[model samples]
Target: MATTTGTAAPELTGLPLLGSLLDLKNDSLGTFLRARRDHGDVVRISAGPPGLRATVYGVFSAEGAQQVLAGESANFRKDNAFYQEVRESFGNGLLTSQDEDYRRQRRLVQPLFTRRRVDGYAAAIATEVTTLAEEWRQADAGTVDVLQDMARLALRAVARILFGTDVDAAVEIVEKNFPDVGAYVLRRGYSPVNVPRDWPTPGNRRAAAVHRALYEVCDRIIAERRSSGAAPGDGQDLLSLLVEAESAEDGSFDATELREQVLVFLLAGHETTATSLGFALHLLALHPEERKRAHEEVDRVLAGRTPGAGDLDALPYVTRVLKEAMRLFPAAPVIGRRAVAATVVGGVAIPAGADVIVAPWVTHRHPDYWEDAERFDPDRFTPEAEAARPRYAWFPFGGGPRACIGQHFSMLESVIALAMLLQRYDLEAVDTVVPVASAITLQAAGPARCRLTPRNP
Candidate 1:
């Protein structure tokens, strides 16, 4: 059923039955890098037993990525084993929806993330970041877990800017269960001995419970919005817009679909940003010189005020730092696609039904596009430097039409949070810790412990 092109692709073999699945699960980034280094751009990696077929073509070059993500995207679909993990945890939301379902959801959901709409959220984001800075300011000197703190901040910001009245309940549920939910999804995705989600395994039960709680929370929010008759512009929240936009028939999302969309926004919007922000601050804490430069830029730009979206352009250095952080450790490191038809990518044949992987983790560090690939250098994002590299070379937010819809929202939120935090607090790394690239997102295995000290303007 699955076959490569005329010239067979280099393949990475693993232990019998389990195959490369263990290698991938153990060290995904390392496994992908090793495959690319041993083979060329397109390498076939197989897992599972001899009788069963489970494979993914690891493509780690710009040209190869463009072919699958842009050039011949129609030949691929999100309905694949890779996204099956996401669907099991998140349901039939935009992230996992396929075909006409994806089309309709995208059409209805796209408007809420438009640049103008995202810009309107800047003030609230700035306020939330300022509030967080003030809270940390109270603890003049203390060590805090950067990832946990940032995750909380990102969740609060998303709740305020997107959901109106139900923000508190949503935040509580996510705070309590997101770690378990995210961990299960990521682990199950790469587990060779895949188990049905309904199976009463401990992990499965926990994930199921989290999903039920989240769904119930979403249902409550929807019900309140319906009873309150909140119109679009009445609350200017994402839920209100969906409620107002719904039609009797054709191109409208029903209650169930609406709940899925909200969870999508909450899960996707917050998780990726939180992970990236945690890494960004961690990187800055590690590099004092970069931290100083970021502080200098913030000082000069705002002089001493909270930052909003308008300040983003002026704080170019802060933006560059965030960009560079994502380049180094992208939140969604791998973009997984499945071949719906046999296709050729970078001159390598890809069999239909094969999982196609394009990782920013690999491409962002490709020697051809970067001078010092492993180094933490924000200057690489400078206008002139970035212009010199290939477009798909540093796609932290990904590429093509299916690229992350919350790119603008994420950027705005990160920039404001970074600026505000930098202006008011000095976060110094208290420990050397690298994040573990996991099934959901790249996350700190332990905690990103940092000493926080209030700074004077």
Candidate 2:
């Protein structure tokens, strides 16, 4: 069902000065839910003072999602204010670029994530996960912070996949400051007022410093790659692939292009996988029955051998578990786009300049599409059950042309990582209740601690 096409849209009312901005910022999921319940799917949330313009329409229906993300995607370009603000840090990276430049960049980088190329990365991913598991065993600790440990593993895995053997130095720089760098950028991007970096405010100063640190990491990586003068397409790593790639016009990606793309991949790729895996492990830990099933499936399929690219399809249960985890806690919870031209969605007439928000967190849990939506049930992702629902109902990686390029890599890496970990150890959540916090990516609000009991061979 397409959104009712009309001019009237219910506006979410608020106090005189603030509107719903503060609530939206503080508790985005809660705020969106309240608006959807009270108002219709197309609810207007207004913010800012009398003169300044700050208004965003929350589109919570699958129809609206298709309209903005797929059907009428061209009318909703990535030149939105949010992406503009994000571009300050991301530069003209694929995540931030629009139109021709975005398309060309996508073309050049698309081959790197192809099935063949990503399959080549399986051994390195397995190696990283295996090494992390061994270190945990050696520690012999009672409890480990799953979120913290997963973060480190994700960073190291991505570092090796992107840089191969020359990852030690770059990984250190990224690991140390990645959190602060992400927090600073997100904080400023969501702030109502745009504070200039040169203003020297505490937040501004912090963002500037973190920005420099992140750029330094990217710069150093690019510089090292360039100095090596390795033949394009000489190696299997992503950097090598990018160096070897030629544009439609037969031009190579320059230094700035390389840096921006690498930065986006580093930021978007690892965090999403790490957060989703943490949630999956946390959920599995809480459900012994499900964990047992997973273990049984792994044992039947791999027979205690390390998981590899070929084993991914054979481990259906592991894939289902990951899908369910993402359904409940999508890493990119909200997808926003600015209407470049006048459009009507779900019966509401949207003006040319309106900011439209499509939230997976909301739509994925909608009662119409999902049964027992809040429950952690991997069975919901079984082929039969998934085929029964709308295609857009469970899109954790988004849809259409601009959907996540590395989704396949993320999924494969996750399956391998989880299978290897579960094969060697049984994990239980230490924290009875883990809280969720949304930064650039959705993550555990506090430490999600887990106790690992090593399995005897």
Q: Candidate 1: minimum summed lDDT over ten consecutive residues — where?
A: 243-252
Candidate 2 has an lDDT of 0.84
Q: For model 1, what is the alpha-carbon lDDT of residue 44?
A: 90
Clash-forming residue pairs, model 2: 3-346, 3-347, 4-346, 4-347, 5-347, 6-347, 6-349
**What lDDT score goes with residue 212 in model 2?**
81
Q: Which pairs clash in model 1? A: 5-349, 186-439
Put down candidate 2 lDDT per residue, 1-457, tens digits, no spaces: 3343587789898778878767776787878878887887888889777777488889988878877889888887776666776788777988889888888898888878889889889999999998998888865475778778888888889989888886787778788777876776777767667767689898778777877887877787777777887765677788878877886574778988888888888888788898788888989998999999999998889898988899989999999999998999899888888887777877787887888888888898888788778889999988999898888888899888889999999998999999998898898888868777566678677887889898854
Instruction: Provide the clashing-pair count of each candidate structure.
Output: 2, 7
* Candidate 2 RMSD computed on C-alpha atoms after optimal superposition onto the true structure: 2.0
Task: List TM-score per model, in order.
Answer: 0.94, 0.95
Task: Please give, for residues 1-457, the per-residue lDDT of candidate 1 as tens digits.
Answer: 3234656688986887777877876788888888887887899998767767478898899887877777777877786755788786777887889778887788777777788888989888877787777777555357777788889999998988667756788899978877787777767766556778788988777778888998898888888888885545787777888876644444577888888788888888898899888889999999999999999999998989878778879989999999998998888888888888987777788877788899988898888888878899999999999899878888888778778889989999999898888888887898777657656667667788889877874
lDDT of 2 at 16: 86
